[model samples]
Target: MISAEPFVSGKYLIDGNWVDAKDKTTVINPANINEVVGHVALCSEQDVQNAIESSERAYHSWKRTPLEERAECMRAAAEELKKIIEENVSLYVRENGKVLVEAKKDLLRCVDIMLQGADEIFEWSKAESLQGPQKVIVRKRPRGVAAIIMPWNSPLILTFKRVVPAILTGNTVVVKPATNCPLALMAFLHVVESHFPPGVINVVTGSGAMIGDVLCTDPRVRTVAFVGSTETGKDIIRKSASTVKKIYMELGGNDPAIILDDAILDEKAITRLRMGILKAAGQVCSAIKRIYVHESRYEEVVGKLTKEFQHIYVGNGIQPDSMMGPLNNKNQFDYVTGLIQHAKDSGANVKTVGIKLDPDTWDQGYFMLPSIVTGVNQQSEIVRAEQFGPVIPILPFKTIEEVVEMANDTEYGLRASVWTENEDLAILLADQLDAGAVFHNNHTIFQDLHLDFPGAKESGLSRETRHCGMEYFSDSYGFAN
Candidate 1:
């Protein structure tokens, strides 16, 4: 099912053209490291400088482009994206090392975000009339250039989330895709870039350390949008402070899934819970990292979940029946395995499930079976940290107050979920939880795209999606007569 052209794109897409860089980096499929995916050009400092210069020059004109014209461009880009998305699904799975189903969802989300932006941006673009003593009129204007620094887990969707809002609001953007899975996203970007002005959307690949800070510290870039670890986000914040630019970040999340006493353990609920834990092999920023089950139902929850996880098929991404793929890179694979080893050494009872499709070659890949760990304290390394792997710790608690305390005792407060048949209890616990978005019943990739996703506490700063985040791309100026 592999094709030759799924990952062919310009090295540095600046000024609507592909310029090759001197250094090249090879990309390997994490599922089978022996199988090389492709090679990407590692951009230098000069290449980054050229991109910012091009983006700044385009910003002056792009910001001036009429609203109707910009709207039409977005619509056209959305349509083009729709036609090519399905074709690129296979490429995404191979490049990103996620299952086929997850890869499809990632690509489709890109089209959905683009289409939604094309329509909703117009709704808020209108100037408002204020009935004040001075009769002031308020209008939101573009903030020149925006820098989009993205992560690899769901590169296309995460990149588009920032790219759509930034460009549709009349601001030019420079995108830095994660070094791990940059090619698949760039293929689609190539199509969208052809429709826009020469330098309206530029992309630079390779190491973020070499050229990441320039985008944040540059005076021309008025806003920085990023998705990654808390440590990296903090670094970006420090760099962005130099220019005092606005920043939109979605950082690390130690998401908690609380199982209330009245929690429904039907097949559907169990499936949804497993999804929350295993989606993208639990590499998602908002995945259920730690689960707190009521004491009365702890045994049943573990038993049911163990059976569910056992049936899961772990294999290469290209396999149609693969439910989960390997970790995206060696660094992550090593980090996750290390956490599991530490837990095991600390006397934690670890239960592993899932069948490797090819057991003989499993050692050659960065694959790990799904695991459930118990007998760990709240301060245990696995319990306190974000595993970002297939391993999840299931803890039992007697009191709601105690469970709430345990769940909130982490630096990450991105998202959490409450699973229960009682709606009142779910709402009450949701209010008490320290997460930004609380889900009832299900916590999958399926979410209302219109809702505002605010990053609470250490998880992130500001908000993402919906009206609040869309507004971050521009500034509102009031004119008084």
Candidate 2:
């Protein structure tokens, strides 16, 4: 007897219909060696036009729907999304190469994000009443069909960040997920389509260069919410300017984590730091790329971190014991490995202290050993650039002001963390830091879904805030004097 496909439907969803693309795109499980786990239809220009046209058609009624009704639909969608968490969690681990446990957490986070938007963001959506003689109320309406270009890193959460909030605020969405990681988004869209009104949500997967222009340049697209590299974000901004649609961008980050001398080194702290640097193979946009340790504890910290790092099992995420998984794709793997090697070439001492990742299982896959590099010159590329990999460079610092200057020295400042026993110092450093958000005594990977998420300078513009989805979701909320 023969087995059946894990997922039978292999087409794109647009306007409440399962549609085919001009060509089929192969989706290989990142954990397995190019295993044909699933498939997604690659959208063409025509497909983009169709989805946008459908969104426009639905906007008239969707935007006009009472706030209560819209909120109910959002609640339903969130519930539906919650129900499929386990199913898509497995797909995320297999397709995106995240640890199976983390993958499950990612899906749960998505549901939590949606539920928050449904429960709280709507509370802010109501128009307030004035006391004097006149009822001047402010209301936030949907901006029409938003074009969300989601990144491959944490596909589920990134996709939910835009899709759930956009829809809950009455804006229809036409999503274009990164080709490298589209399965989770595709599955989530299916669940959403089943509950929401037709044409309210649509997902099309394909190369951005080809189909992305349609979303960026088209007049029908009222807003573009994107998460990716700074360069690509700029391109989207330039193109979308023609239509003058609102742009919300969450781009790259070269974040740092500071370890103060007074901080205690518990087993929990070392484990958290290790996970922060190596989670998702360090492909996370907010991963701790640079570790600035207090010179007093530098040696001890490195010794403890390396010892803990050695225990991580790297292999196919299907295995229960595997903690670290392979990189998303080959290009990312090569780029990350190149950065580590270049750091070594630049006189940085690189050390691998992880369960020896066997290459035999990844003959045609992307994989790398978790590594720590020390003796790195502060000015070197490894310390300065955003190497999105399971790697970290250690640099010693003596003074608080000195470390603060070093942390702000880089061009990218998306996020960072400060570990110190002194609450006053942590608060002071958090305020002075150039990054968007700073955590006290935590790794840079810490993310509260309800907080503001955006970068400064080259890191990007306008954050994705959690509680106040008002700014992120409102179609046009501005005041006139």
- Cα TM-score per model: 0.97, 0.94
- Please write out the lDDT profile of model 1 over residues 1-481, one tens digit for every residue: 4456444542778999987667877767888888767667788887888889999999999988987788788778878888887788877887788998889888888877877777788787888999967899999988988999999898998888788888888899999988788888888898889889999999888779766778988898899998999999999999999899998889999998999888879998999999999988889998999999999999999999999999989988779989999998899999999999999999999999999988988977788899999999899999988899999999999998999999899988999998888888889988898888898987755355555676699898875556525787889999888
Question: What lDDT, from 0 to 1, does candidate 2 have?
Answer: 0.79
| Residue 66 displacement in candidate 1 (angstroms) | 1.7
Candidate 2 wrongly placed segments (more than 4 Å) = 1-10, 129-136, 357-364, 444-448, 463-468, 476-481
RMSD of 2: 2.5
Model 2: per-residue Cα lDDT over 1-481, one tens digit each: 2123334235777789977555776767766654766676777788889999988898888877876777677778778887778766767777798888888888888777776777776566766654555555555677888998988888888888778778777788898888877877777777767777889987777778877799999999988988899899889999999999988888888889999998878998888788778888898888898999999999988898888878878877767888888888878877888898898888788988666455667555676778888988689888888889888888899998899999999778898998888999899999989888887777653355666667888887776565534467575444333
| Best-matching candidate per TM-score | 1
Candidate 2, run of 10 with poorest lDDT:
1-10
Residue pairs with colliding backbones in model 2 are: 450-466
- Pairs of colliding residues, candidate 1: none
